[model samples]
Target: MALAFEGKVAAITGGASGIGLATGRALLEGGATVVLVDRDKAALDRLTAELGKNCLAQVTDLLDAESCDAMVPEILERTGRIDILHCNAGSYIGGDLSETNPATIDRMLNLNVNAVMKNVHAVIPHMTERGSGDILVTCSVAGHSAIPWEPVYSASKWAMTSFVQIMRRQMLPHGVRVGQVSPGPVASALLADWPEENLRKAKEAGALLDPSEVADAAIFALSRPRNVTIRDMVVLPSTFDI
Candidate 1:
């Protein structure tokens, strides 16, 4: 029999667009009630309305730990339990390191790395107490190998990869599964900051993946048997190299 989420509750950050929204759609179809967390209030309202009653919207800024902490309790208030957490909120910084603004680097690191850590910290204990939960971080192929065009972005993802591994080990004993979905270039706003040349190169090379494909990967991991975990998965455009 296949896995199902008939009564599961999932909260996804960056849920206003891209992979987060796509993943929320998939979970809703699988019978899981989803909370779409995003900083954009308008987008959240629109998306939540589109997703219908199975989905709720929580306007939040993941960059703030307090905002991250508030999501768990809010979900509990409405749904009574949190069965899954997809830390899908993240940003991408592209281009040469010399040309990169240090401040931009700091902001990216906060969203991509620190925010993930904080969200996990806030939710893990609740999951442990319940004796089960799943944490899925949205990582990147940049984490697997160094990309010259976006060194700092790669570093943040590398940090997430490390965090996922460590969390997986630590959470396993407590019945919480931690994993990551590392994708190659996707046609997302994250790529909005990419240097024109790199974006053109990736487009010309057919290296841009669709957000829905990554969503499918997430659903697969989430559907695994309780005793089994998919761990880490990398989804890339077939033509994308490095």
Candidate 2:
């Protein structure tokens, strides 16, 4: 497993904190060059110091199409190649659909759905041409279920769920693998938008997973033998329900 990641280069969005950060650390320890992609420069600077050599940062705003599109070429220029692309950057907005702010909808959908596709679109050419690469997205259990409380969020994930499936087939013939790691309620910044009662109850019920847990699943998927494709791995806290 260690040898599998050695000499590999991985570009991860939302790489400054949460699951992305955890995965970046794991990959670095395994001898892979990890590119931390996020809009937070301060966090990226701090992480670069802690993560040491093998770790790089791509300070990008996923919400902006041009910024998002430009990251792949930028990383390729810096690293020469990207063996792994983890589309893990995303935002969360919950509660009644009627209450969803117009601007928030644009931001969340753009980040969660559009940015992911745009990033993938940019990488498709390079990976297909090279004839090898692994692409994984940070999906959600919400994507697998309707979860009425957050319809818009679910709607976005549903789009992702379908996109991942179709993209996998498209990339399969090109020797590039595509998949997703869908996790349940994770103790990450995404919960900052969750209601207080919901967060408290999720914690009390032991229903929230740590970012490292999700990172483990992600690495597991990425480390598998080229012949074995882990299309989707859904991880949930043992106590989590629905």
Instruction: Compute the lDDT for candidate 1.
Output: 0.89
Best by TM-score: 2
Clashes of 1: 0
Clashing pairs in 1: none
32-134 in candidate 1: lDDT tens per residue?
A: 8999999899998888778899899887887777876687787788888889999999888888888878798888999999888888888888899998999
Off by over 4 Å in 1: 1-3
**Model 1 — which ten-residue stretch has the worst lDDT?**
1-10
Candidate 2 segments whose C-alpha is farther than 4 A from its true place: none
Q: How well is each residue in 1-97 modelled by candidate 2, as lDDT tens digits?
A: 5656999999999999999999999999889999999999999999999889889989999887788878999999999999999999999888987
Candidate 2: clashing pairs of residues: none
